[model samples]
Target chain A: MSSFVERRLSSPVKVAWLVALTWVGCVYALGLVHQPDVAGDASGGFWALVIALWVVATLSVAGLAGLKLRSKPGRLAVDLLTPFLFGAFLFFLWEVIVVGFGVPPALMPPPSAIWERILVSTDLLWADFRQTFLKGVLAGYAIGCLSGFAVAILADRVPFLRRGLLPVGNFVAALPIIGIAPIMVMWFGFDWQSKAAVVVVMTFFPMLVNVVAGLEEASRMERDLMRSYAAGYWETLIKLRLPAALPFVFNALKINSTLALIGAIVAEFFGTPIVGMGFRISAEAARLGLDMVWAVIAMAAVAGSAFYGLVALVERAATFWHPSIRK
Target chain B: MSTTSIPLVGAARPGLLGKLWRGNVGPVLVVVAAIMVVWYVAAVAMNWQGVSERFARMGQDASAGAVFWQTMAEDRPMLPVPHQILVELHKTVLDVAPTSRRSLVYHATETISATLVGFLMGSALGVLLAVGIVHLRTLQKSLMPWVISSQTVPILAIAPIIVVVLGSIGLRGLIPKAIISAYLCFFPVTIGMVKGLEAPDRMQRDLMRTYSASTAEIFWKLRLPASLPYLFASLKVAIAISLVGAIVAELPTGAQAGLGARLLAGSYYGQTIQIWSALVVAAACAALLVVAVGLLEKAVMKAMGGRP
Candidate 1:
């Protein structure tokens, strides 16, 4: 027994396994004990066990990370598994603590209950996605980004306008642009149109500013080389400047993708035609449907991530020559 | 291509008018005037329908010129003209007593307080998390991805839930809004700080290590100072986003005290001018806040012997 203990302590991986086992054992022991009815009334043993689990888990994770797996596949697996395991363990702990304490689902639904809510509410989630993401956010993002780019081109051509407008534009962008949601609803009436307008307003200036900055990205030497070839303004702009500007343009796009979604969602809160993520979130919360709200939140999280990922994918392909993308 | 085309350096070489013409202020003024003209025209075109209907209701004959002026001065124009918004802003921000609930200044103060609190909390949390992640290899691998994922969820979708849930827990008004603002603000600061903290090159880090410096010593002497520029930049972004968060928080709660509430009230009553004024005030507040951060950056950088 003394030799086995020494062997385990001598190896990082063995030490990690020992710590993880102890954590699980403590959790199992805690599971056997009667938990308090309320989180506020948690006993000293419960608190002590929770603190011990945190320390044990932390040590295990740190030890695992410190192991230095030699094989490429092994390192990759460890890299991927760390976050996945951490996230899963966090959810498991949350579910256990909430359920064990008999906490009200209305206040904080356990992960299992939220999962069930998500499973049952597929139709509602799809409808909300259609109303918010498809109709409002997509349309607005396209319109806003295109117009902003077009204006940026025009502003680049006209230095006077560029000098004049950039300051005002930045100021306008900095405002609580979400505040326009209510007024847009009043103007466009309680529908996706209003939401789209809010998104357009929210996304426009960021795109404009980034694109304008991007147009100036080509250094003096690069421009001088283009001029040496006697390339016209449009020719120089298309071949040299725009390519250099692609990275900056993509930055704006990524930002606008998230902003457009957020703007559309928030616009729905004021007044809307029944089906939308923002409307459902606000309405369900009022009714204390915490599980349903979490379900919608999950939908939003997935959609937003997908949207951002799509932009990033396009950016990587388009800006492959850029230093950030170059392998 | 032609660096010489860049304007000459400013010195004691020009008259006031010449200087004004060459300066940013003049071009900005010209653009502002041009926008005002276009806005006035748009206001007349948009408000004419409602104003003319009122005129019809009163059985009065009105010329186009009279109608245009009337639209510009309407109590609640469909699209508030620039002058109408200016007048409304004056009344709400200056003419009305500061203590009055109707005053924009009072609403602005409420919003600003919430924004400041949220910004401070978010920045502190972000720096703390960034420091831990940088020091802990496990946390960097585990938490960083989740941190990125957390931002993908629309804040609007969660703001209402957070407000409702926290409200149930008896955390009301300022705290909920601050949390939401912090939620929005922390991401940029974390990403920026992580990059900032890692900014010192391998040589510099090795130098510190060769000196037998402790982890805290290296972080304080090398990493923290190197991170200042990035930290300040992200802080400016965080502060602006926090202000937006505070306003959005107010919106979902139907609160009656902040700039968001003022916007909601204006929308409820179809008070276009009121909404415009509130928006202007919010914009001015944002500009000032950003400028304040920029000034602080300058001061700190100067103190640290960095170029401002």
Candidate 2:
């Protein structure tokens, strides 16, 4: 047994086995929490066992982190698995504690209950997703990004406007731009359009500021080279400045992706047509349908992550030659 | 690329007016003026139909100029002009007693209190997490991904739920709002601090090792000081979003008291001017918080012997 322990502790793959055993131990502890007597009784043994499992799980995760992986794939696997295991451990703890204590679902619904609610509410969730994410977030993101890009170009052409706009843009970006949601809802009525308008306003300044900074990224020498080549304004912009500006533009895109989702969802809190992630969250919470609220929040998390990931992927493709992407 | 066509104003005039025109202030003022003009036009256009309907209801055959004037003066205009909002702000923020619910200053105070509480707590938590991550390889590997991805999760969608849940548990008033604010602000600080803590290069670490310095000593003397600039940058972001979180938290509570409550109440009653005034106050609060952080950053950086 001592030799087996020593062998497992010495290598990355063997350490992964230790991690797997600890994970099993955590699952077994969760099972113990699910036992009938544990729910009703505040037992000392159950608490002790749970704490012990937690310690073991934590140590194994730390051990996994300390592993010296020699292969690229092994390193990548560990990189991905560490966070995944940590998140799993947290969810497991949440489930165990909630179930063990028989805590009120209203205060904190367990993840299992949230998953069940999500499973049962697909159609409603889909409709809200369509209304908020598709109509509001996408439309607003595209319009806001394109207009910001155009204005940045125009501002580049006119230095006077650039000088004036940069400060204003920075100032506006720092302000609580979401405060305009009520006004947008008032103007555009309580539909996805109002949400879209809110998103547009929320996203525009960030894009403008980033793109403006980006447009100036090309060095003096590069600009001079373009000038010596007798490049026209459009030619220089396309060949020199725009490429240089790609990273900042993508940074703005990533920022705006999250902003657009948030603006749309929050705008729905003002008023909406019986559908939207925000509307559902607020409406359900009022009714104390905590499970459904958690369901909506879970869906939102997935959608937001997917949207941001999509943007990052596109950014990677578009700016592949950039130093950051290359790294 | 040719510069000969335009004469240099500084060389020609060398006056204050010329300096203002050539400097940042002139263009900014012009832009602001232009925005105001556009806003006035938009206000008139948007309010036209409502004004005309009211005129017709009152059996008055008003001229175009009269209708335009009425548009600017409507009580609940579709879009309130700048002066109407300014008047509302003056009435609510200046005229009313600071303690009154009708006072914008009262609501602003509520929001700012929550923002400051949350900002302090969130930044402390962020610095703590950053320190742990920097010291513990396990924490760096495990928590970093989640920290980065947390910002993408639209965590504010759960703000209402948090407020409701905490309120149900008797954690009412400011604490629930502060938690949301802290949640919103902490991510930036953590990300910034992690970067800042790792900023000490291999050479610096080696030199510290050569001195036989303890980890705690190195952290306090080297990492903490080096991380100030990043911490301040993130603090600026955190403070702004902290204000946002406070306002949003106030929203789901349904017009109790706060700038967000003012906004919700105004929206419910079609009080466009009220909403605009509340928005202005909130914006001012955000600007003040961020500027305060920036000034603190400058002072601390200066005290640290950083370049002015």
Candidate 3:
């Protein structure tokens, strides 16, 4: 290598530095405009606060850029720090823009407000999580997916049923979740179970369709080879078709993971005993507690990501041979 | 050639309906009929016990099936009986009453108008975000995972926050709905578009480069064209999600109108039939929107010099 070890900082890093300097000047100018006597309550001094925060932000960004400007190991330190600093900057920007612009807290609570809510209301969030995620989503996802896989297997065996069922499944899919959610609540009552039922309905058809397609993924030649070995349908399905179908199955799984979460959450909006993300969001919005609503949102997002990540990990393990996974 | 001849053979045959029905329609019908029969029988069996007792108390000795149908008919907005919904739809479509909230047609038009606008805005945002992610590999790497993660955060959980945030900022009505719809619709479009845009081969890109074309030119000519299948796939998904998003947004704001408002209104008053009818209308609307997208996909594909 000519000099692989002696690389320069990326263009983004240089831009970050320039941005830092400009932001510092703007903040300093803004600080000058802040008059303590004229500052109007929390609303009035918001701009000055943003400017003060910007000053701190500039220092942090500059420090990060300087670290990146260094060579090798030092640059690596910046690479790790860059994301955290960027995240901080994003939170800062969100806070300043909303406050400085005099944005209503009801619509978009500042990041600090969201964090405060998170800090104060761990127990409520946990209960909501248990209702929506643990009971509703997990149960519904498992049953829906398992039922879909089983039904798809049966449909594959009975070709006529396949022809008959798929269109109807498509019909079922076209029924909007909102349309069915309340009815489910009526039939199943106002608990996690109703939400679970909605999830089952929402997830079932996609999985069924995907699995049906996945079952067909085994090539004609592969099936012939399996047949030549005197294998039965079940044996061929298990040993050959199942392996080939892993990627498609996992595709459905990943898709269902999202759908299930959505279904469970939306279903709760129709009716609940009141401890749910949907309920909290609805109630909080009514109360104009935008910060608490945001806090709940953050929890849902983290949980959702974790659930998706778990599914993705399982997918990687199950479909290691898939080209998409390999990449 | 085989594909061309298959439908031709069906068209050429007399008694085609019977032949088609035997192979396809018959089984589906049989299944539905059987399911209905079983349901009817079960209702008859169960009707003797639960609701029958309640009906008796009310001086009504109705059969389980009759009570079920009556329940469906009486259920407001969302849970309308299949027959009642058909009747209400007729009344609505016929425009029998010009000035009543009870008129299904009036409510539907109002809701659909907003649903469509929000849907269009959401889809546009999704497409733009997808383009950005696809064009910037770093964004694709960093933002893609985050976008996927974003959905896990329940829309319900965030809808109020969004509604209140916007409301506080003096933004209301369609904007909140559109924003929520965008949140739902964008993720699919972004992921789908990223996959679609990258669907082109290295050889294709190299050929484009040989023409001395700018990146923008290459994108419009090659990347975008290659992305059609993916776009359509996601558009269907995005559109449905957009409808749902619009509905959810309605929930937080307590909007006096829209399908969501209708649903909430019915639920609050326990107007089960009204709720059912509204739900049916919404489903129909969603289905129609999906079909419209499918039709547009066909037109676009045909224009692209391929058979739809």
Candidate 4:
């Protein structure tokens, strides 16, 4: 029996099966025998079992991966399955712990409760999204990106401005620009406009620095070819420099997507009318509405991920010819 | 082609004056001078209403020069001039004792302390996570996507929740603020370290394997050293963000001390000069911290026998 067990462990497929079985057993223990009360009031033994099961499941998954799968599909399957299983397990643990332990709803609401709150407050969430993401973040991102690109072009034309502006750009980048949210609110008043202004300020410097760096990406040989073709500054820039800069420009876009969202939200915290994600979070948290706050967080996470994913997808398409993507 | 036939521009021997004019300092000074001029003009425009209102209340017909001067040097203007902020900084830093609440130095220390604590916690966690992720494919697969997705959720939106939750759990003040700072800081470090750890080419890693080096041996000799440059670059970013985190964390808590509080207090009383001074001090602190990190990187690289 010992030899049989050792032989099975030596095979990656058998090890994967063992991991699955262990996971099933852990889930059974968590769900059936040691299930705590609605208030999560459970004995110490029950909590101990939960912790032990977590450790076992974690180890099993790690063992399954460490043995190393030979087939590409097998590796891909393990990679895909691992995070999904881990994520599900974490959520399960969170739900069980919060529910079974009777943790204060005010301090830590269960995922189910937050989900219900999200369902009930769809309209409110939509309005806040419109206010923060649609109006403030998007508008600011467009303006900031355009101005950064334009200035980068201008700086490329003028060596003096390039030297002068790059340092200034670096200096501004180091400033905790999010701290300017309050001042921006004061300047532009307590509305989405103020938040948008803050987003612009937060995002502008990053884009400028990135585009300036990106503009230098074209190789000397490429520029020489342009020069040989008798290309003017505008022609060389448009045909060679700009294309080479796309990867860096997209990097800035990806970065600024998060920055813009953060700026708008933080700006809302200082002062805002009834609607916006930041305003909602601060307001709900103040009222001890932890569930509502979580709901808003879920919204922000989805929106942010979608925004970032969109930018990345665009980058992939735009930079397909680049060696980094070609592989 | 017209361009192909054009004469090549040769390097010219420049006089001292020409060299000075073409240098970085000259351009930077010109830009700073331009900004100063613009700021002074904007200050006058923004403060004109308050100046005029005060003059009217006094029932005095002021000359244009008096208006200009008063606008530039108001007791509490809507937008304080640069000199006004300078005066406030001098008074706050020099006139009062550092321990005083009213002094900017006290608040700066409080914030900086939190920032440092948070940065240490964050960097330690980041390096550990990177090490784990690099060794364990399971973690790399599971943790990396989540790590990438995590930053999308703005910490500012969640800062209050963290503060209130932790506050209720009987943890308060510095720990909560530091946690927020760590949250902001850890992402950059993790990303950088991951890239850095994986930086060693396949041949280099295979060399370690050929020598039958232990995992720890490989990590210590190859991976860690290779990751230093990326680690330091990210460390600078992390430190700056940590400061921002400490400041933002102060905002939601209604904390009595910190740079964020100074800005808040200034805003409450419409003390524009106070706000501007705090901002300037924060910027200066960020600059100093970045320089400090750069120096540390030099020392670390030198010790590692890498290029400084």
Clashing pairs in 2: none
How would you encode candidate 2's per-residue C-alpha lDDT over B1-308 as one tens digit per residue?
22432576767665898788777899899999999999999999999988888888898986788899989988899899999999998998789999998899998999899999999999999999999889887788888899999989998898999999998988988888899999999999999999999899999988999999998999998999988989999999999999999999999768388889988999999999999989889888888889899899988889889997
Q: Which structure among the candidates has the greatest TM-score? A: 2
Ranking by DockQ: 2, 1, 4, 3
Listed models, DockQ each = 0.60, 0.69, 0.40, 0.53
Give a tens-digit lDDT track for model 1, residues B242-288.
99998888887788799988888888888888888998898889989
Identify the runs in model 2 with alpha carbons over 4 angstroms from their true place.
A1-10, A40-42, B1-13
lDDT of 3 by residue, A1-327 (tens): 101211232455554665576457455534433334322223545556566666555444444443335367766765555455556566656755655555666557667668888988999999998988999999999999999999999988877687677777776676676557777887688999988898888889988888888988998788888889988888998999989988888888888887888788777778799799888877876888778777877887788878878988998888888888787
- In candidate 2, position B53 carries an lDDT of 84
Interface RMSD of 3: 5.2
Candidate maximizing lDDT = 2
lDDT of 2 by residue, A1-327 (tens): 323333456676667677878778887777777678777464888888878878777776776677777899988988998899999989998988888888999889888889999998899999999999999999999999998888888888888898898888899999999989988998888999899898988889999999999988998889889999999989999999999999999999999989999999989999999998999999999989999999988888999999999999999999999887798
Residue B171 C-alpha lDDT in model 4: 94
Candidate 3 lDDT over B158-258, as tens digits, reads 66667766776789877877777777787778788878988999999999999998989999999999999999999888888778777777775678777
Candidate scoring better on DockQ of 2 and 4: 2
TM-scores for candidates 1 onward, in order: 0.91, 0.96, 0.82, 0.92
Tell me model 4's lDDT, rounded to 2 decimals.
Answer: 0.85
Candidate 4: which stretches are off by over 4 Å? A1-38, A63-78, B1-20, B53-58
Which regions of candidate 3 are displaced past 4 Å? A1-87, A99-104, B1-51, B58-81
